[model samples]
Target: MQAEQAGALTVSDKPTTPMQMIAHAVANGAPVETMEKLLALQERWEAGEARKAFVAAMSAFKAKPPEIFRNRAVSHDRGKSTVFTHATLDNVCDALNVALASHGLSFRWETEQLEQGIIRVTCILTHAAGHSERTALQSTPDTSGSKNHVQAVGSTVTYLQRYTLLAATGIAVQGQDDDGAQGQKDQPITPEQVASLQAGLDETGADIQGFCKYMRVGALAEITMSGFGRAVAAIDAKRKKAGSA
Candidate 1:
């Protein structure tokens, strides 16, 4: 991730312990070497390298998120755009809604409600501009019922704390509360509050990249097309697993 991309992410103040780094890397099934690599890259960013090696690393981590996202109704998007889609868009929208809510910028969405019995799910986010973003998602059940032992809600909420930091820093537009502008006369999330949110995320043990994972929902929307990757991963994983078996 570039500093521009890193600028979009929130970094922690405390140096992460090797044990904690290993646990996070393993929990997500990430390569243990990944931590050292990412940390070194961050060091370059700090040292004014202007150009450290920017091998696409986020794609590798999103390959799997330690099942932390699955049970919490989250999904990995290896390489994709962050926009509305007919499939694979709900998670990002839901995550955005959650982030905005933290700053009193809540809005109503009907994607999940409408997709309850239908196979097609379209996630929507309505802004004050009298417009919205929509992503159509196709929900598929895991036939093997391999979902009983994944991470719990605690992990999901913790992950959210990490994301709130990114929301405030990446772009002022993202941090702006549309609700306040759209006739809901609420207070906007201030710059100071944004800084505080960043601080809080660090206090909770979020590593730099972990914070990126938390906020990548928007970056995925802003930087890559996410739905395409989700569809591909689902199909490929099923086919590869079946072939190996």
Candidate 2:
């Protein structure tokens, strides 16, 4: 019987996976407790494989990051008109859907009213293999331009959804350069600063997406020079809290 089982296992030219082993054991009438152990083992192996697949897909997706152009403009109150452009929720979906699908990934959003006026939006990015990651951001409704209560909530939800998706995918908009208008003092952080912040995140095991949301930036590289000190301080606070814990 042992010889037959060994032969059965070795018959396949490809190396056997945990699932395959478990299946074979079940077919050979393994004991109930042994079957339970094999089942747990198989579950773990599948989860590990799914995680690895998710990482590989993400790496490939980032290799040629999608360029999302700003497609919408908003006008504030007053005689003066501000011509700032930003990528809308529709634009983000149109830009990322095809690319994400090609890499076996998809994203969805969940919204919750955390408080009377505050809304939390969570973006869940999932791989076809079953691994998933989430990025969430909370913000109050936008009452600018005299928007009504419903419009204000809708606007805030849309805004949070757009940002959460970008945060999860680590994507930034390639839009018209308004930095000249904002002044040199508002320039993005240097490469060295970005590297330092990245190292801090790694050491502290902080969520990059959450950090980006907290900093009001799409990505670490988009953090402004003026905000570098604050970013460092935030990381330091997290590190100290972790240490004390």
Candidate 3:
């Protein structure tokens, strides 16, 4: 359900949860009914305001870049002490140029109207889809130690930087990492576990049907590896019967 710069990634490193899926839906401009269904499935949002903010962040994330930037060039010489290299914003600008031709969506920057002392560049993905008028979304500005992202779905939409994988993928995949000092994931599943799971299934005749259920990360222990074991046990009898047949 995610696409990187331009590669097919199995994405075993990160597994998205129902809550994260719901959040992605909201971010991608899902309908009210869809949001309600999502809200019911995941109780991550307790307060109404928190729910609203979550939805808002998601909606903006699905937008594609609608601005053109400068180009960059690099030159290196073995004899030179300092290498001459310059990076340009050209790629961003080229993306913006292409995004303008999409449907009736008019892409524009809204930084001048900012009263918050921060620039907010908006790409109006408008008049398309179910929207009657244009939807104006501000791209999170690039600032030191600050982060911003935008993505909208049904198109090559957006979100994040180093955390792009998280935003592009889902928050659940990045939750533990974000909580840590360094942005590194802490999922503990291993090849041995999968092998163990297979052996455990064969030995105790544990249900293999529900095994895919455990092939994911959980926010807590009850929903973690141990919980997966319980799930296998719960379906053991059924799988044993099926296997014998």
TM-score leader: 2
Residue-by-residue lDDT tens digits, candidate 3, 101-154:
343332333222222221222232322322221122221133312233321211
Task: List candidate 1 stretches off by more than 4 Å.
Answer: 1-118, 146-245
- Which parts of model 2 have CA positions greater than 4 angstroms off? 1-15, 78-81, 176-245
List model 2 lDDT by residue over 1-245, tens digit each.
Answer: 99998887778633378777777777789899988998898899999999999999999999998899987776543565445667778988999999999999999999987434556688999999999987766555666577899999899799778877988999988964331234433888766557767877898999999999999999999998567656865876787689889
Per-residue lDDT for 46-84 in model 1, tens only?
443221211112222223211112212222232532222
Better of 1 and 3 by lDDT: 3
The true-versus-predicted C-alpha distance at residue 43 of model 1, in Å, is 52
The order of the candidates by TM-score, greatest first, is 2, 1, 3
- What ranges in model 3 sit over 4 Å off? 1-90, 99-104, 113-116, 128-245
Better of 2 and 3 by lDDT: 2
**C-alpha RMSD values across all candidates:** 24.2, 8.7, 23.5
